[model samples]
Target: MDIDRRLKQLEDSIDENVIDVYDSNYLNIPIKLAYYEIDKYSELVRELNRIRYACKTYEEKELLIKDYIKIYLSSRKMYLRILRNLNNGAVKILYPDNLDEDILYRALKNFKKFDRGKPLNENLNTFMKVKLKQNIQDSNQELFKLKHYPAEYINTFKTYIGSKVLRYRNDLVIYKDAFISETEPHIYSVYFNEKTAEDTKNALLNILAYLNGHPSFYFTENYNFNRKLSELYDQFDLLDMLRLRKKFFFESKEYKEPIFLELPVLKQRCVLKIQITK
Candidate 1:
């Protein structure tokens, strides 16, 4: 936690590998202490600036600066804890030498949750979930209403709609075996199904069109890929109402429906309830 010690590590870091500390929570590891090895100095400066901006509402810059310093200090304590608990033999066999602080922090930050023997659900699995969670909570107030609905609905809907739209798209098999959950607040996630992409895409598009009186927001007869969605939505100037999935809905290129419009934002009942295949 000492600033001097962290500053020393940051100055010495110079490699590109992670160091997993198995004995504790992965993310809590102090990363700033090992910043010397982080490759892009520009990125560090950018991040620092962003953090600085976030703290700007405070009248005094001193308080804001202290907050950033605390973040770095806390990160270093974690790094040291990981180093202390590493298996003696595993450390020798895997690393064989001291690592620069930067490499150690980067490696640890990138550490897969699996490294700690946790289940896939415990792991973030992907950044998509993070983005999805943020969008849904920030945008879909109505859909979020369902979260407060009786659990019975959440537990039963997919079977309720299985034969119709929620059925399996890949085979004759139905999503009678599906289930749904919220990985993050407001993000209603059904177990991935054969028709998941289609079901979600259509449901969202239909809702958006119904609300906006547009021709069911579509590509300009040319846009093709999930990455272009923001551009296309912006081109049509629909970005204010559109959002990606795992937050409010799911998104996949294979699924004809790429964006799920948040109907709840208008404070209306959700046009469709999710069906989980069990």
Candidate 2:
């Protein structure tokens, strides 16, 4: 199978609005590969066609089709992550108005219908609402706040992006009840792409840098303890690492807990483990 040609064709068909990688049912999983713009979608399709043409049996063609979608989904998510960083403002601006009303309705109205799914439609709406509202209600406030305490925004978005990456799943887990976790867990069990870990880490780093704050802190020579931590690029089990640290917290400032900073040391265990006791 000429995987490269198919990947290129798939990429060539992509467009910002025509086929929203974010909205597509096929591309919603955690993105493992970088997104291809519309120009590149054709390259992916060509490769897919090549694979189909080369397949000796129906099963092989089916396998190739599955692989093609899976890879494209992963790449799309990765692309979304890139946009999450490079175009945070744009994402923030367009999300609310451009939301797919049908999806939103299905998600909200048919909660009982899809038992294990992420309430994807619902989740999408909520994410957009929260992000857009924050951007809208406090555009100036966010700017002022970020300027005053850049780490707050940086830390906030980093956790959100990282958590999104970590929590991506192939199958949806549906529940009738609202979800809650009794245990505070930190985990980084995102499925790894066959692609280089460096690509994923670099994409993350790029997003981290653009999140309304100082990308410089990630490079502090004095904070060598947390600097780069390039080793984390290979650590596919970040979720487990996080869970072991037991220091994970929601990225909300309103929460009365501390979230993990993008520090390298926490990869092993919490360096400053704070215990609350009577």
Candidate 3:
């Protein structure tokens, strides 16, 4: 109920050895969130409580709570999405070994986006974060007022922050998967059947300070064609938006076909049987 108590509970729940299920079929599903660190998550809980007791409702409370929700909401939803969308009834998470947080940047050094004709010169190029395409809802406002959706739209693939396997649930998952499509149809998904890297886990918890909203999580920019920013953050379905993560980082080479990266899932058994009427 309180910060320390909750942190204790979370500490209790984490077992780097904890596994979700034995079925190998589900292992391939994860994209990547981050290596999860209970201590880091604990810090967030503490920060939020500090704010709660320190701030009045009219003060930063609303904004802080909003930021607090942003941190945990996606985490709470991840495995649930597997149970909901995928053909599953339960999901389990694990503390990663290296969850290999350092892999992405290293991999990206030689990273060539899946669909792009040119390989990225990491020093000279950045994996642009594409904002989800959107339109003016103001009863078809002036053409100038409409959002400047990228011409590449869905195919504008982005980089993988391995921790994403943890921080984001269905939304980031969808986006990553869609990015996979941008590669080649031969590219398939895979996971570690274990845990992630330490940096990867910590990275997930590190963003807690960005209660104001982290630009790294931006799916689409709010600028119009003229580059003016819009106040509204519109929504887009993954079906409309699109795509997850892994290995191949230890070696220095271009991406090999048929796979994106490997996210690790534990092999221990943890299940919550909730009856649902589908």
lDDT of each: 0.34, 0.36, 0.29
TM-score of each: 0.19, 0.21, 0.19
Worst 10 residues of 3 by lDDT: 130-139
**Which scores greater on lDDT, model 2 or model 3?**
2
Cα TM-score of candidate 1? 0.19
* lDDT per residue as tens, model 3, 107-197: 4444323333443222112222110001111112212111231111212333322111223221112221122112223221221111234
Model 2 lDDT per residue over 1-278, tens place: 45555666655644432223343442332221122233353455565666565655434544554444545454544455434543433332223345454554454443223333564444443444343334333334434433443222111011112222222232211112111111124322221222224455454443332321112122223444443343443343333333444443444234334454443321234443332211
Please report the candidate that would top TM-score against the real structure: 2
Clashes of each: 22, 38, 39
Highest lDDT model number: 2
Badly placed stretches (over 4 Å) of model 1 are 1-93, 106-204, 208-216, 220-278
Q: What's the true lDDT of residue 136 in model 3? A: 14
The lDDT-based order of candidates, best leading, equals 2, 1, 3
